[model samples]
Structure formats: structure tokens, C-alpha cells
Target chain A: MKKQQSRPNILVVNDDGITAPGIKNLIEVVQEIGNVVVVAPDGPQSGMGHAITIGKPLRFDRVDLYPGVEMYKCSGTPVDCVKLAVNKIFKGKKPDLCVSGVNHGLNNSINVIYSGTMSAAVEGAIEGIPSIGFSLDDFSQEADFGHCKKFIKAISLQVLEHGLPPATLLNVNFPKGDNLKGIKICRQANAKWAEEFDERKDPYERPYYWLTGVFQNNDKGEDTDVWALENDFVSVVPVQFDLTAHHAIPVLNTWTFDV
Target chain B: MKKQQSRPNILVVNDDGITAPGIKNLIEVVQEIGNVVVVAPDGPQSGMGHAITIGKPLRFDRVDLYPGVEMYKCSGTPVDCVKLAVNKIFKGKKPDLCVSGVNHGLNNSINVIYSGTMSAAVEGAIEGIPSIGFSLDDFSQEADFGHCKKFIKAISLQVLEHGLPPATLLNVNFPKGDNLKGIKICRQANAKWAEEFDERKDPYERPYYWLTGVFQNNDKGEDTDVWALENDFVSVVPVQFDLTAHHAIPVLNTWTFDV
Candidate 1:
């Protein structure tokens, strides 16, 4: 009798829906390393952050998209997709690893807080699984993802071999260029989007606003993700879901709160 | 000639919708200290992390709910409420302080990542405003909030007097009790929701799932938000929008990624 070996099960998720080229490219790369199980949003969920659908009922449908891989399209946020996979699909059995995105746009610096792609990976980390979120610095639907496969595979393999630290996941951003520099492990830059709303009138002449913003980098730190991305390097930021400002705790403790 | 002293402008937001008792209580307290401008979701936006409305058009209607306060009900997430208030409602003039919720439920520990209430404050912090998010441990719509006003006012006044550290906001979770202990400035407890899906059949005979979870606190640290909340103390956690796990960067740098 021949001994059978089981492949590692990998849960792949993205914010750019199930049919997006970014996730398709991600699936193609990760499929080589494990048994891929994709549970992603049914539609574009960009800027959705870590939202989970509570007020509305969630529906998921199995689709035959990839050969030899199980795929489910979820009518919920990226975080909800992870929950559905862990609880309903996998029946509480944690996967070997979770990978989110090859996101349509960058989730670097301040964008990490507003990224549905990174949020999926963060959700995976919260569920006690090593996770990585990949993104390219391109927003176009026709953006090329050819250069991202090697980096994605390298990072995925690394996370699989050595699990990420507790409560932490990687936010990997690929610079959009032909001659790509190597990966750089860096911290999130102190950067923000200067919001500018485009005010316009609806058919009823009521004013409506469209959210738009310009990325502004105020930090001059060379070891930051923004700096690495600008230098054509794949910036790998070890992102944590713990929002605690540990340093500020001591300062706040000093203040008397006698109302 | 007497110099006219202008009251500090405060932006109030919540995830429990504009008409929810939580925001109404929040507006009532903050109005005592500043010029209150309430821009909150029109409907419940619970579990809506740092989500923003990008794909869909956002509409906000000026509502006259609170006396001597400007209130707007926005058709977007809590984070969207912050953006709309900053860019459109206030017309780019940053408010002196941004406060979100007397949230119906606790946003302690890992809950902060999935909280629309905390996300609103995080958004405000990203936009360089001194911000704070308040939540009660109770989840009932008719939960008593009389015990939270003093702590809320104290924290709000503190943030207004001495601005928070750059890029940092406060996640304040109040214990649901009549005799509440003093505030404890603490870190986010290492905790997570152990997801349990309640599978059921819809009207069409297809299976649909409702997301339910158990709060699991594996961290035994006393200086944590969870510990503080459980001890009948108001947990004041200084939260930051920067997702970077700074401690893990050096460890990741040791790993070779020469693929």
C-alpha cells in the first residue's frame, strides 16, 4: 500500500470580488503551494476595511472557477468571507495559512486602516492563522500582475515555514515597475489621505459628495513602507490588529479623571 | 471691547445610527463642552470597522433632532460619517475634537478592529484630530447610559485640553454598572471572538448563516482593556491607526526572501 500525503489547505480571499484579475493571479500563484480554498466577496469591496455584515443576512454560493480548488462567493465584506470560511465552510478547522489579495491598489501606510484586503488577512490572524495580504500599486482593472507572482510565492512560503507572530499579519505592497527591487521589511509610514470631497447635485438638485483624497507622506523615515514602495521595493509591513497605543497608556495614566 | 471666545467645535459620530440612544446621549454630553456637530449613519453600522463608502454615492440629510446642535444623518458607514463631516459639512476646517459613540456594545480588545464606532474615531485621528470612542459593555437598545456621562465628559475634556499624541485616539469602554470604578488607562487585551455560525434555512429553503461569536480572552494581563472592563472600571485604551507591528519588522528582516 502506498502512503498518501495531504497538501496544505490555503484559504484565499480578496476585496476585489471573485472575478478580479488580481485575485485570479493570486490564486494561480498560491495553488502551487497548497490546496486552495477561495472565499471572497461577490462584488468590489474596496475601502471596506474590516467591516462585517450584521444588519443584513449573508449569502454564499459555491462557484466552479478554478480547477481542483473550492471557491465560494460571499455577499458580505472581506472580513465576513473569512468568518464564513472558518465557521461554516471549514467547520471551525483552521487552514494551514490564509492569503488575501493581490489587491487592485496599494494598502500601504494609512491605507492599511481603510483596506478590505488587509482586513481579510487581519481577520485570519485574529482566528489564529498565519496570514498575508498582497497588493500592487496599481488601480486600473487592466493592471499587470505578472511581476507579483514570484514575490507572492516567496512570502507565502516564508509565512508557511515560520508562522507570523501572534495577532500579526503581513501587509505586502508591490511597486508597479518592470525592474522591481527586492522585498524590504518595514514599518508603516506616518502618512494620511488629505480628503477632498467632490460636491455635486443629484437629479433632485440635492448636493451629494464623492470621497476623494491625495496621499500625503509627512514621515521622512527611510525604514518606512512608503519609502520602500517609492524605491521600487516590495514593502512588507507586519501589521497587527491590536490598535492599542501602548506608549500613550502611561501618559494617559498620569492624568486624573476626577469628574 | 470684550474679546469673543469661540467654543471648541466637536464632531460626534456613532455606528448605532443617528437616532439611537447611544449617539443621542453622546450628543447631549458633548454639547455642554463644545459646538456639537453630529454626522452619523442613518442606520445601524455595527461591526463596520474602518469602512468608507467609495463605490456608492453618499448622501447626508440635515436632521434637527438635538436642540442647539447641528445633526446630519449620513447614508454611509461610521468612518464615512467622519469623512463627510470633515470634507463637506465642516468644509475642511478640522474640528477641535472628534468623539464617536456611547456605543451600545463594548469595543474592547480585538473588538476594536471590527467596530464602526472605534473606526470613526480612528478616521478622525488619521485626519489629525484629537478623537475618542466611547462604548458601554451592555448591548441592549434600552441600556442605561446615565452612568457613562461623567466619564465621557471627563475624557472628552481631557482630550480637548491636552490633545492626544499624534496619530493616536482613545478607545474608552465603560462598564455596565451603577457603581462603576474609576478609569484605567490600559492596552488592548489580547482577545478574539471564537466564531460560531447559527446555520438556518431561509424562506426559499436555502441555508443562510447568522454570525455569532464567543468572547475569548487568553491574555491574563491585568493592565488590559478586558481586565479593566471586567473589574467595573472604565477602560481607556489609547488606540492608533498605524497597523504596523514595529517589533516584528526586525524579525522579518532576518528571513531571506531571495525568490
Candidate 2:
């Protein structure tokens, strides 16, 4: 309820590392509307999903990334960055709004499950903060994020002004073109990646594998995030962390799962 | 539809390394009912969530840990193990059932979101397979699993016989005790980890942090997984990967998201 702070404290995070252009553009946009603090991965953590560092301790350090913008980098996954920001940096005095990514690639549909960028935002939502994750469809190092800045600002302002529903976060994805149609409130498209691993031999002739996949969108629904992006519109999906399929509980009760 | 094969082809995976006692116990129980193929992490990948390795290629090799059990160990996450099992090992033919874990610890409530064990089951569900993840509410290396086998078999048989609801997986958690009550169908409890970082200075005087937390469950709903676990009953929560907050969509549509 108190996410609508005047000169809101915005925690900025991403999966594409601290140095990526995506975070820079996002920081610039968020700074216009709030006091920004950036805590991102020290390296590209794409496809890191909702992973956290448990097997090893983390190295967190403050860095002078952008002039006048307080920033830090962590040697862990994107979700780790959010935890560090909340536990260590912010120290439980949570930011008013938590925004993750203007990621180098799309985090639409099923990609949200495997996106480090989105995972950071999910962690923020779990911390009872109004959170949003932004992503641009382009994946190159020099991917143009110019078209996304205005929309990002608008969405962040709206979220700060009107706090999000409890346990929910916004998943926003923008298409590649400059002449965008508009914004669409959409559901996550029923989609997945068809994986193909390229098997190769190492120097000693031991076999190794490279993970690759083709984006597959079989959902023909017009109200899906994937559909909105294809039509040049920015897509926004309200996502929740409760994984329970509430609908299935009644049917499962009919089963005899015994002692 | 064919998860009820006469001799089910079960794809087994875990976040714990291939040699972990948890998976070994799981494999022993599953062998009586189906042909099992296990693809698990080469090392401990706890808290890895749904991460897939994209930054580097993976090292996958066959291991002879169990006699006549088709087992492979991968230098990747639990999610990656499911992917490799489907694409590389099974060549997309698909397994009859995909079961992940018998994790060394609990993956109930909000822990499901950060659990590598549950993430593997989620991956399997995404691949349109009938999947389930099992966890015992004990974090000890020598945790007793003898009481869990019969219940595990009963649930697996039910799932194979009846099949899970589409795009859903079962997150089954057992309360650690030989005098277990029984199984109860439940929903994910609204909960989170109140994280605290144990900051320490290294030998070189550089600061580091060990991520720690206390599980906080304020949800008083008697129909939640937490309640089921706490009351000495096995918790069987039907989980889904669709992060879309369908209920929030109608309200978000009322927002003025402009061009």
C-alpha cells in the first residue's frame, strides 16, 4: 500500500549484467521518476531463471558504473542481486518500487520462467514490493532501447501511483521496431522452446553439449503477450509467484493417493 | 496419454548430485514399477531453480552408479537435466513420466519457486509430460526416507494411471517421521523467506556474504501445503507454470496504459 512514495526509491536490477546497455537505459528512465539504486549481476546471467546462490558465498561490491547513480554488482544470479539489495543494501527498508531489466532479449510467454531478469522482479514481488520486469525483443549488444524508455517511465509512474495487486508483478516486453503500436494488457502466451543441444567433442574427445532452442508459440489467442509483440505492441502481463493450479485440486481429490 | 504404459519410461532427476542418497532411494522405489532413466547434476545444484546453461556448454556423460539403471550425469541444472533427458537421451520421444527429487529438504509453499527439484518437474510439464516432484521435510544428509517409499509409489501409480491435468505438475512433500498420517490435497501457502545475509570478511579482508533466511508463513489457511506438512499429513499440491495472474488481468485492463 505504501509503494507510492514521493520521489520513490526504485531498486533497479537485471540478468544481463551491470554493464549492459539495457540496464543503462532502464536506469536513465527510472531516475527521471524516482531515486534509483542499481544492483545487477557482474556477468550475463541470461537463462539463469529464479536461481539463488546456496552452494557458495557471494562477492558483492559497490561500483561507480554511472555518474551520480548509486550502483553495485554481485557475483551471483539476478535473483541473488535482488536478495542482496533487500537484505544487505536496503536492509529490509524496502524500496518503493522494484524494476528489473530492459533485458537484451525478450522475456515473453514461457521465457519468463527461464529469465534471470524476470526472476529478479519475482523476488522483489515476494518481498512485498511493487515490481515490474522490462525486456526488449532485440538480443544484440547494441540493441536499440530508445523506443522502450518512454513506456518504461509511464509504467513505472503508474505502478508507483497505483500500487500493484498483492503477490503480483508486471512482465513487460517491447518489440524491436521504433514505430510501436501501443501497449496491450495481455496474458502470457501458451508457448515454449523446442530445445536442441549441439553435441561437440572437447580436446580430449570427450563429448560436450551446447543448449540451443527455437521459440515456439502455438497459442493462437489474440489476448496473449506473444500476439501483442508480433503486432508491434508492447505487452504487459500480470504474473504471480504462487505456482498452485487451484483448478486441479478438486479433480485431484477424486484420486486415491494413500498412505 | 501414455503415461500409463505397461512398463512406464520414467525420467528421474534431482537437484542433489547424481550420487545423493535421496535419488538413490527414489530410483529403488521407481524401478519396481517402470523403466527409469535418471539425468541429474554432476554436483550439488540446490537452489538452482529453473536455470538453463547458456553461457557455457555442458559436460554430460554416462555413469555406472547403479547397476542396469540407465543413468546420466550432467554439468548443468535440474532443468537442464530434464531438457537433456528429453532431447539428447530420449531424442524427443518423451518419457512416460518425469519425476524429480525426493529432495533432501522441503520444497513446500514458496520454496517451490526456488527449488531446483520442482523446477525439473515444471520443465517436464512444459514439455507436455506428466511430472511430479517429491520432497521430504528433512535437510539432513542421513534423513530417513523409508516411510516415504510407499506413499511415493502410490502417488506415482495414481498419476500414471490417471495422468495429471494438462500443463500441471504435482509438488509432493512428506513430513519426516515413520508414523506418518497420510496424504492431503492442498494449495501452495502464501509465504516467503525473510532473508538475512551473514556478511563476513575473507582472508584478504574482502567482504563476502552467505545467503540465509527464515521461512515465514503467515498464511493461516488450513488448506495450504504448510498446514498439511505441519499437521503430519503428506502435502500434494498440484502446481502449474502459468505465471499469469488471471484474476488481476481484469483489473489491470482498467489501467490507462497509453501509446
Candidate 3:
């Protein structure tokens, strides 16, 4: 008989703080596959893309939030939680996998650029761990995540079995509602937020501005994340952190810079 | 007679706070090209990648920092400065170009993923403005920037004349010495910071940690940004915010995920 392999060690993190129901549901699903460790932000960290706490001191303490799982609440951003887990908690022993979110809202298309949920997975990829970030299309305090449990387990198990490519992570977005189609491998849609500042007076009558934006999708490609999500399919865009635009190098080299 | 073209409006921003000498030198060089508007963070915001202010209200006010230049100091991240400039100052009219950071330190290779300097430029590109972020290999309060002035002007003028490719910006890094080679268009190096947290105690004897890391570059390709910078060439890596790893999708599609 073949020797049974040891269980994989999985690091769980999120942007929606430790108490959010989304992460709790994720923990329940993943714990069946491996030994899970939870290290997440203490407060809501929506849109805090790739941010690390540099100017301030960081604090993380062990918590009993989930049954039969080791968990900690971090007083920092989502990226900081990953850093802390890697450097302090794990003590330089890299985990078998790092998974972030089952985030409360959508992280589709251009939203990935501004997402703390996706940034945690990006950080994990940078750390040489097979990683994935999961998000739902709904934005509610009590968002329904029932449709995501089986899908999340399947994806996580596949990553554990197959492993991911270097410098890459999966940005997975699930469509809202229970009647879901299968997953679609897609690219990031060329989309953006058209920002408008609602200038208002504070209690002391000083003028302040609250940022509000409308999601604008201009890319009409059928193989985009936005299109897949709109058609009720789970969209998975493989994300890499290397920002180099390789196609533009030849054009840039032709320009003269002699002064 | 030829019709006279109006002066281009340029937006200048940085992560090194409003009074940093790096930005001051940049302003002096770019002012000769067009009408200048500066909106930058009031404090240092290094390693703050693509972060936006959503929890608290933001405050910004006009300041007289440079002669013949309009300036504003914002109480937010580098990305916030760009958004405020676009919505509040420019009033939805896109500037001719946006330039961020003649930075005090280098944003080569993996540093670009965590850099507030490059994040500002990325924010600009997302807003459909041609953008460039410049950095020096040296990290000092009074680093010599005389050698960068002419080069900065040349690059900025080129971007203004011929705008960048769709959804792209430049990550330009200069070598630390006066004996400089010409510019090299390169790709982002495959590199990362090996982090080590220094555990220490506070005044009350509670333990806290400070993040410190050594940059590890294993990529040996001469066409990479790290190689170009190490060889004393000004490296320009055209960067895009779309994190999609298009090459990895085919492999992922073969994996089984049926639950």
C-alpha cells in the first residue's frame, strides 16, 4: 500500500475582517481538505489594494472565532496579515497554499485593481504559494454564499493537486443566485469606475467629500470577466503581479531621447 | 498662418509628501513644458499600493509651493491625490498627462507591486491619462537630482507628444551615479523581498514588529528592469494595471473542478 501523504497546510485570509460571514463559510469548506490557519484584518478593508501598514505598528492576536481552526485577528490591512502570517506566525515555513476571500462583494474585471481581497492573493503568489481569491457578485452584510461552498472546495482541491504557475493567482468571481452555470476561463475586462465626489458639510460645517463611483464597462469582448459574470457563469481570471507591458517595448525603443 | 495650440495641462503627484526635494526638482523640469498642477500626499506613503480613502473623509487645500504652479496638499494616499485632482480640481476634464514621483528610491522589479509612486501613475492610466513614474536607485533625503532633470524632461515631452498605449504607463528608474548609460526598454524582473520582522517591545513591554526585508533578484535576463538598472542604464518598464496572466489560462482549463 502507498504511504498516505500528510494534510496540506492552508492559510486563510480576507479583506472583510475576521467576523464576516463570507470568510466563516469559506473556513468551514476548506477545513475539510487541510489544516487551516486564519489571519485576517480586524476591520473592513474594502478597496485597500496591496496596502501594507508601514507608518504604524502592527498587532495580531490569537482568536477563537472558528471551531477546530487556529485563527488570528490582525490590526492591519489584508496584505499586512499575509506578511505577518509568513514572517511571524509560520516562521519562514511557507504554507502549502494561501487562499483569500469569499469576499462579500464582486471582485470582477477592473474591481481587481482596487480589491484588497485580490491583493492578498497577489501577495501570496509573490510569496511563491499557490493562491486563489474568491468573491461573490452580491454586496450585502448578509450576502448568500450557499452556492459557493461546493465550488470553492472543488477549486481549492484542484489547486492543491495540480499547483499553480509561477507568479500567478486565480481571481474567481461567482455570479449571484443558486442557478449558476459552469466556470469560464476569462481575461480581465477593460473597465473602470467613473468617480464623483459628493461634496457635503460636516457636523462642524466644514466641507468634505465622499467618494462615489459608477462601474463602467467599455470592453465588448465576449471572453471577458464582466461578460461571464453577467451571463451567470463563474469567471476565473488568472492574475499575475508582473505589470510589464511587453508589447509596448518595441514602440518605446524607437523614440528618441537625445537631449 | 498655422493655428496656435494651447499649452498642455500637466498633473504632478508623488508619494514622498508635498515638500520632498525629488518632486520639487521634477516640477522645475516639467514647468518649462506646460502649465503645471501639483496634487500630492501631505505625508510619506511608501509601500501604499493602489490604496484609496473610503473609511474617513478626505481634506485638501491649495498651497503656494512653487512659483507659477498651482499646488494642493491632500490628506490621503497617492491614488487619492489623482482621483481628487481629476474630480475636484480638473472637474472631469482629463489632463494632457500625469507624472508621478521623481522618487527618492527605486521602483524596479517587484517593488512596483508595492509602490505608492507607481500606484499613482497606474491610477492616472486607469483614468485614460498618459502617465509616467520616475525613480532613482538612491534612497536619501538630499539625493542629487541634477542628472535626472534633462532626462525627465525628455521622457515627459515624448509622452505628451505621443501618448502611451491603451491602459499602460511607464515605470522609469535611474541609476545612482553621474556616469549614466542611455535608456533601456525592459520587462519587470522576477524578484521579491525576503521579509524578516524584527520583534521588539513597546513602552509597556508589549511586543510589536517592524517590517524589514532584503530584495532578492534571481532573474538573470539582460532584458529585465533589474539588469538594466544594475548596469547603470535608465530602465523604462512599460507597466499596465491589467493583472491577467493570459499564458496560464490554457493550463488551468485542463484541471478538473467538478464537485
- Each candidate's lDDT (Cα)? 0.90, 0.94, 0.91
Off by over 4 Å in 3: A1-3, B1-4
**Every candidate's TM-score, chain A alone:** 0.97, 0.97, 0.98
Least accurate 10 contiguous residues by lDDT in model 3 chain B: B59-68
lDDT of 2 by residue, B122-204 (tens): 99999999999999988888999999999999999999999988999999999989877889999999989998889999999
TM-score of 1: 0.97
Taking the tens digit of each residue's C-alpha lDDT, what string does model 2 give over A170-236? 9999999798988899999999999999989999998999999999999999999999999999999
The CA-based lDDT of model 3 is what? Answer: 0.91
Error of 2 at A253 (Å): 0.2
TM-score of 2: 0.98
DockQ leaderboard ranking: 2, 1, 3
Q: Candidates ranked by lDDT, best first?
A: 2, 3, 1
Chain B TM-score, one value per candidate, order as shown: 0.97, 0.97, 0.97
lDDT measured at residue A219 in model 3 versus the true structure, 0 to 100: 96
